[model samples]
Target: MSNSLEILQKYWNHDAFRTPQEEIIASVLAAKDTFGLMPTGGGKSITFQVPAMMMEGICLVISPLVALMKDQVENLQNKGIKAICLTGGISSDEIIDLLDNCEFGNYKFLYLSPERLQNDWILERIKNLPINLIAIDEAHCVSQWGNDFRPAYLKIVKLKEYFPKVPFLALTASATKRVQEDIVKLLQLDNPAVFTKSFARENLAYMVFNVEDKLHLMEQILKKNPQPSIIYVNNRKSCSETVTQLESLGFSATYYHGGLSPKDKENHMKLWMNEKVQTIVATNAFGMGIDKANVKTVIHLHIPPNLENYYQEAGRAGRNGEKAFAVLLTNPSDVIHVEAQFLSVLSDKAFLNLVYIKICNYFRIAYGEGIDEKFSFNINHFCTKYSLPILKVYNALQFLDRQGIINLSQEFTEKITLQFIIPSKEVIRYMSLNKQDEEVILTILRTSPGIYESQSVINISLIAKKSNTDENKVLAILHKLNEKGVIELHAKNNDATLTFNEVREDERTINRVAKYLEAQNKLKTDQLKSVLHYIKEEKKCKNKLLLSYFGEVINEDCGVCSYCISKNKTKTDTSTLSEKIIGLLKIQDLNSRDVVKLTKYSKDDVIFVLKNLLENDTIMVKPNNLYSLKN
Candidate 1:
């Protein structure tokens, strides 16, 4: 077998591994189950990919996101390594063929979502393969205590029973001490060797600006960091609004969210990726598979629900090992709303049950009848029909999904797919005979491959550009071709998916799951408290606080963070200055500049002392901008 470094050089073209990666890879190569706790962009994928190549049998990688799985698979294939992923929306026959390829086609890696482990045929087939190593990505999701918990991860433990000798590698970017323990016990790994790296990103400067005008601060940050940047907002509307504001300010920007059509999302991503747009105003859904290394800034316009999310999203800023800024722009009202919105959703049993029943009625699934049935759900349509609150209903659906009551999928199909129903010769003959439709059909054939064999995704705009016509004209021609029985065209759709994991359960039945909901609510509440604590904390180092949350300790503060810099710049201790200012005030009233001159302190320090004194009722700011003792 080739050594890990040799395989890394051969495939990934890297000289060495990041800190704990080499150690973790060595452990896995030694046939020991390993657990890696590293931050995002920590090169966790290499730990498994390199070792899997060194081993003899196929490496079964169980991941959560379909886009992530597909991306890794495509990346491996581009490197000439045989890889396949069993993702959603594939037929049983296709799954069988794919698994067979893994078994017999000398494939090195096989990727699958945790939900696919429940299939009997998949399990039967997997039991026979020469499985080498099992790697779990986003392993924190297995713990109910962790963020992004998915109950389907429970099925992963059964793999231990089937492949007793196979070593397991569990990897995640962020997990608390409790979540780490839960991952070990739930995955049933046998005495796994654990490797943890500090969550501190020294290159990333964390800043929180409490500004009355957030848009102004955002504009200033964008102006300072003219490189590629991401501005995260709380909702889709904010994304569009931010983009509009940036464009109005002469910044090339675009927006992305879950609500956008697949085509629009693609166009937005392509524009950002190609640097045609300098900034992308987006919700949290924008960063999963994105790897633009030179991203100079990541600004959060609205506070995230938790610090874990905040850390993960902000960590995207400095992947190139260069200094970058991760800023959170908020006001007092924003913080209040963040807390209020979370409180409204926590442990609302009635609301959750209402959503559950409405979803059942929406699908016409009578109680106790719809088991394991999946439907293409449109939240807008359902909300309009039932007059339900969209945000609450959406949160309730997410709560149900986490409880394993139902599977709500937001990864919608975004590509325009087409396949020729008639023979290629017949298509050619039709195109030749029909001169008006010839250019569009020929452009479709040239732009997208495999259309003759199977349905392949096509870019309508690209087709239009190639055909020298508009998108509507190209789409109309494709529709005409569908009518003529020459092809089958599938347009991009943004509908979400709702899968009924079990029969429709009543409120009483759902009450059992309510306990899980209660637990989840408590988890969310705790996470929100952490966010509030992070925001309110003034004395502690920001980097130290973040590292401490993930159970790591640092002896020295990251002196480069905003808090540290401010701490360094303030020469006069606030307590001493407050005392001097209050004593001076008791003697006689003094103006703001006069107080600064008497104390020999900067204007900011003087102002800080006066504000403290005012809050304590020791002094007051009069209309003349003078400080006076208050009774």
Candidate 2:
């Protein structure tokens, strides 16, 4: 077997492992159950991937993120390593072939979602493979107390029943002490060797500011940094709006959200990655598997749902060990808005059951049926049809998804079926009579040849391009043809797809998972409260607060965070700072930055003294938008 370093150098081109990574890899190599706790950018994947390379047989990886799984698999394949990922949308036959390939086709890695372990057929097949190691990514999900708990992760323990002697390596980026204990116990890792890296990023500065104008503050932060950066907003609408706002402020920016098409997401991501754009404004969906090392700033427009999420997102910056800033720009309204957005949408068992029944009926699935059946689901149409609140329904669907009752995929797609009721000759004659619709009709005829015989799926965008028109115009033409009895048009827009993983037993299904649903809701409430406290508490150092929340203790202040800077400023007499600011204003009108630069004081101290002067009517702003002495 090759040495771990040799494999790392061969595949990843890294000369040495990060601190404690080599130790964790050695533990896994020794065939012992191991647990590794590292920060988000601590190269957790290296611990498992390097060791797995030196082992004899293929390594089995269990991860909760399908996108991440695919990304790792693609990365490994690009490095000339054989890897396969089993996610949703695969047929049983294809899965069987894939498993067979793992068994004999010299494959080295197979990544599966935890939900896949629930299938007896897949588990039996996995038991027969020459599995040398079991690695669980995001291992904290096994704990109910963790930030993002998935009940499906609890089923991962069953793997032990299949391969009792195979070593297990559990890895997570963020887990508190309580969550850490839960993971070891729940995964049944027998006396696992634990390795934990300190949760402190020495070069990263954490800053939180209460600002009424968040966009203006964001502009100032970007202008100051002027490097690769990310701005995280809460929703899809905010992603585009923030990008637009940044562009208007003379910054090159792009937007990314879950709602964007796959091609668009890739294009936008490349724009930011290649440095063609200075910043990427995105929702939380944008950062998984991202490997940019020089992100100078990661600014949050609002408080994140939980500190775990915030830490992971903020950690995306400064991977190169350079000084980077994680700034949270918030206002008084943010707390109320976050609560309304997350807490108010908590659905109980009864609500979940109601949603379940409505969905089954909406898809016309009878009880004792619907297992393995898939449907194109339009959430807005379903909510409007059932007169249910969209957010509540969405939360309930997510819960149901976590429980393995159904699989919900949020990939947006459009399905259109078209058939011509009229004969082809009659259609051509009718099109000739309508000169405006002739091009679209001919394009559709050329594109969809079988539409005259049966309803066939057609590409509207392609037809639009071929006809020298837009999609809306082509759709209008199709509707016109349908109204005139020339063609049969059936078009449905789907933002999500739903697949039933279990038979529909109505309330009984929801009852089985009622306790979990309640616990999850309570967990969300607690997480939000902690977020509020983290943001509101002003006495302690922000870095210490974040590290302490993750069950780490630091004796010295980071001296770079917002609280530490303010604390240092308080040591100097405020009156002295105010007099210095007054001195600067006495010379000429100055803005806050000018005051800070000229006085050689921190921005926080300068802003503090300026506020005091303004309150005392000792200074005033002239038409030039700079501080001036009141005359």
Candidate 3:
């Protein structure tokens, strides 16, 4: 068998391993359970991939993210390694065939979600495979104390019953001491060799600012950095609005969110990655599995839900070890806003049970039935019909999904099916009369043939593109045609796809996962409180605060952070600050805010110097409150 370094060189084309990766790989190869706590962008995949390449049999890799699993499997396949990922939407026959390939076709890696292990048939098939290593990615999900806890991850430990001697490798980028201990105990990792890389990012400067005008501050930051960067917002509307705002200010930018189509997401990411765009304005959905090394800055328009999320998102910058910045812009009201957004929407056990029963009833599923049944779900319509709060219901659905009761797919598309009632010649006459709708009608007719004979699904976006119009216009034209009896249009606004992963047991099904839901809600509340504290904190070093939260203690403060810089500014002599303010006033009359901006000093110091100057007549305040130098 090839050694780990030889395998890494042969496949990854890397000359040597990064720090701690070689050690983790050695432990895994020694047939011992291993746990690796590395920071984001720390090359965690190398430790498992290199050793798995040298192993004798196939490696069973369990991950919580379907997109991550697919991406990793594709990447390995591109490197001429045999790999397969089993996610939702695949048929049983397809799964059996894939497993057969893993067993007999010399496949090296079988990446699957933790929820898949709950399937008895899949588990039985997996038991027959010659597994070499059981690798768990995002292992923190197994811990209730972690920021993102998924109860389905607990099922991953059942694999140990089948492969008792097979070594397990659990890896995560963000996990505290409590979370690490939970991962070890819950995953049944037997006396695992743990490797932790310090969470301190030496080259990254953490900054927090309370600003009145966040957009203006963001623009100033972008101008100062002017390199590849990511601006994270909390919602889809903000992503698009921020991009438009940045573009109007003469900057190149694009937006990313879960609502965007896959093609659009990929295209936007490519534009940012290839330097065709200077920045990517995105929601939190944009950054998993992304490896861009030259990001000079990462700015958050609003505070994140937790420090773990903030650290991971901020750590995306300066991966190449050069100087970079992580900035958070917030105001006093943001505390209440964040709580309303994240905390208020948390669903309790009773709410989850209600949602579960209502959904099953809506779908007309009988009790103890409805396994593997899928439906197109419109959350707005469902909530309206049941008279429930949209945010709370959405949260409940997400919780059910995490518990493996249902597979919620938020990538939804509008389904439009239409059939023309009028003859082709009469349709021409109608279009001639309604000239404004002529192009959309013609485009739809040309793109969707046989519309007069039978109903057919049409792509509204495609029709809009072909006619050089927008989707809204096309939809309006279709509705007008339908109203005129020219066509029979059926349109359903589907924003998600729901698949029942388990039988409908109503309250019993919910009761089984009630403890987890309660714990998760409590965890979320605690995390939000921590986030608020971090934002309000002023005395501690920003980097040290973040590191300490992650269970790492460091003596020295990161001198580049906002707190350190402010602390240094307070040490400057008052006379020196007054001299700088006088020099600025001599150039031109300026206000206190502008003086602070120009001098790069703390606001209090600038204000203090301005007060002294005004009292001593060194500088005089004009009518408009602008300070001017005395002649």
lDDT of 1 by residue, 284-309 (tens): 87888787899999999887888888
Q: Model 1's lDDT to the true fold?
A: 0.83
For candidate 2, lDDT tens digit of each residue in 1-631? 7899899899999999998899999999889999999988889889988888898899999998888999999999999999999998788999999999999998989999998998999999999999999999999999888877888899989889889999999999999999999999999999999999998999999999864457777888888999999999887757756776787899999988876678888999999999999999988888988989999999999788899999999999999999999998876457547787786689987888899999999999999999989887777657756668876898899888878899988664335778899877898799789999999888888877767766666666567777888878988988888898888887756468799999999988988999888888888898889888888787899999999999899899999998888877546578988888888777888777677678888766666677678779998755445678998
Better of 1 and 2 by lDDT: 2
Please, what are the lDDT tens digits per residue for candidate 3 over residues 1-631? 8888899889989898888999999999899999999989988888888888887889998887887888889899999999999998788899999999999999999999888998998999999999999999999999989877888898999988899999999999999899999999999999999999999899999998864457777888889989999999987657766887899899999988876668878999999999999999998888888999999999999888889999999999999999999999875357546787786788888888889999999999999999999888877557756778877897899888888899998674436779999899999999899999999999988987768866666767567777988878988989889999999998756568899999999989988999998898888888888888887777899998899899899999889998888788737689888878887787899866688889998765775567678669898766555778988
Q: Tell me model 2's lDDT, rounded to 2 decimals.
A: 0.86
Per-candidate TM vs. native? Answer: 0.78, 0.81, 0.82
Q: What residue runs in model 2 are displaced by over 4 Å at the alpha carbon?
A: 412-494, 570-631
Q: If both were scored by TM-score, which would come out higher, candidate 1 or candidate 3?
A: 3
Superposition TM-score, candidate 2 onto the true structure = 0.81
Q: After superposition, how far is residue 98 of candidate 1 from its true place, in Å?
A: 2.7
- Candidate 1 vs 3: which has more lDDT: 3
Q: What is the C-alpha RMSD of each candidate to the true structure, in Å?
A: 12.7, 9.9, 9.4
Ranking by TM-score: 3, 2, 1
Position 3, candidate 2: lDDT: 93
Give stretches of model 3 more than 4 Å off. 412-495, 571-631
